[model samples]
Target: MIIHGNRFTLRPDADAAQIEEALESLRNQGRVIPSVKSFVVGRDFGGEYEWGATFMIEDLQGYWEYLVHPAHRNTDQVGLPLVDKFASFDITDDPDPEMGAKIAALHQRRYDSDATLTQLVSDLGEYKGSAAPGAHGER
Candidate 1:
């Protein structure tokens, strides 16, 4: 299983409605995305980021499904612009030593296929993770 996590801080100008909408969209991802085995989206109590979410998937293929799903892309469109900082991580029990590279490749492929996604990520104040732009040899 792989546990994918994201944490983000909203821009100070973000209004309540936008925040709620983003949160609701995040919640909807777990419900609408079939590849998500389990998930949680909520406020970060003591973390540096304002909100966080975690998604559990059975394997790399499931993770790819989760990433490419329409619902997930919609969430990114709705939520990415409102956030000033964002970071993501993955913890997996898969035994393959190449799993990390494979995961990063999936993300890179997603970005390569969508110019809007690449721009959305570029607009962020900060983004960090193994699959982040420029990370793991990504341009």
Candidate 2:
């Protein structure tokens, strides 16, 4: 499995509403693309990029297909112009048991005294069992 994402900073004069409309259109277009397993776009609350999109693909070929799809291409034509700069990455699933253990131990320490955080970790742990690779906390 592969996770692909892009982060974009909107142009100073870019219209937020119009950009959202364009993103929605792109999302609609993405739904029909065979290569895309799932896709999501959202605004960052407080991050380096103002807007971002994330999607999962089955493999490298699927990733290539998604990149060349007319809908995706069109979205780039319309949306790229509204951005000041952008960065993208494609991540493939590569798990390290040691890292996973360390992460779990860290979470345990951080959340052990907090009810909300404990519950969140418990929920994610339960969900991870049934989720796909790279989904939830699955390694």
Candidate 3:
């Protein structure tokens, strides 16, 4: 299985209503996305981030589906602007040595294909790891 996790800190100007809506959207994503085998989203106690989420997928295809799913994009639209800092990490048990690069490529392609997504990410205070724009000096 592939496990993808995202950690973020909301902007100071983010209101309570938007935060609740974004949290609900995060919860809805796991329920609506067929490719998500399991997921969780909640407060982060020990981490630097204020909130975090993890999504479990069966394989690369499922990961791709999770990435491109409308719910995921919707979550981005609602959540990205509220975010001050964002980062993602992926863990997989697959045997392929190139799996990490493949995952990053998928993210890169997603950002490349979606101008809105690229802009949302670019507007953030900071974004790190995986397919993050300029994470590898690309985009």
Candidate 4:
């Protein structure tokens, strides 16, 4: 699975409910939206994390498609008039489970720590799993 960070800024008139509805519709799509094995969009309920809402794309390509796809463009058509509400927009991608882990492990090893790096790596190494790494209280 590939993960893409897609942060959209809605027009000032758009409300949370409308944004929520748009995301819900996308999640139910049968096709025409590939690479998006799973997607989530919504307003923040509580706890930590930035912004009022966020979108998660399972496939970077799928997300790229949606980013330009008419399907999204059409729905967002209604929301576009309200776009000014947002302060910024952002999107990022990380490859599926296995590779992302190795990449993070490397980063954590290199930039995360030196004195603690060995111990941290060892602790993570203790886990025996084939799947990609999990979120570690990340943003």
Cα RMSD (angstroms) for every candidate in the order listed = 1.4, 14.8, 1.6, 14.1
lDDT values, one for every candidate:
0.89, 0.59, 0.90, 0.40
| Regions of model 1 farther than 4 Å from truth | 137-139
Q: What's the CA error at residue 22 for candidate 2, in Å?
A: 2.3
Residue pairs clashing in model 4 are 10-83, 11-82, 11-83, 11-84, 12-82, 12-84, 12-85
Return the clash pairs for model 1, or none.
Answer: none
Q: What are the clash counts of all predictions, listed in order?
A: 0, 0, 0, 7
**TM-scores vs. true structure, each candidate:** 0.95, 0.62, 0.95, 0.38
User: Candidate 2, residues 35-120: lDDT per residue as tens digits?
Assistant: 99998888865777777788888765676567557786567556756766565555667464354343334334433444543343
Question: lDDT tens digits, residues 1-139, model 4?
Answer: 4443323344445587976666555444324565455555554345332223334555434544545555554444443343332221224455344654443343333324343323332333122221112342121
Model 2: runs farther than 4 Å from truth?
94-139
What number of backbone clashes does candidate 4 have, counting pairs of residues 3 or more apart or in separate chains?
Answer: 7
Assess candidate 3 and give its TM-score to the true structure: 0.95
State the lDDT of candidate 3 residue by residue for 20-65, as single tens digits: 9999999998999999989999998897999999999999899899
Global CA lDDT of candidate 3, please?
0.90
Better of 3 and 4 by TM-score: 3
In candidate 3 the C-alpha lDDT for residue 35 amounts to 91
Leading candidate by lDDT:
3
Residue pairs with backbone atoms closer than 3 Å in model 2 (clashes): none
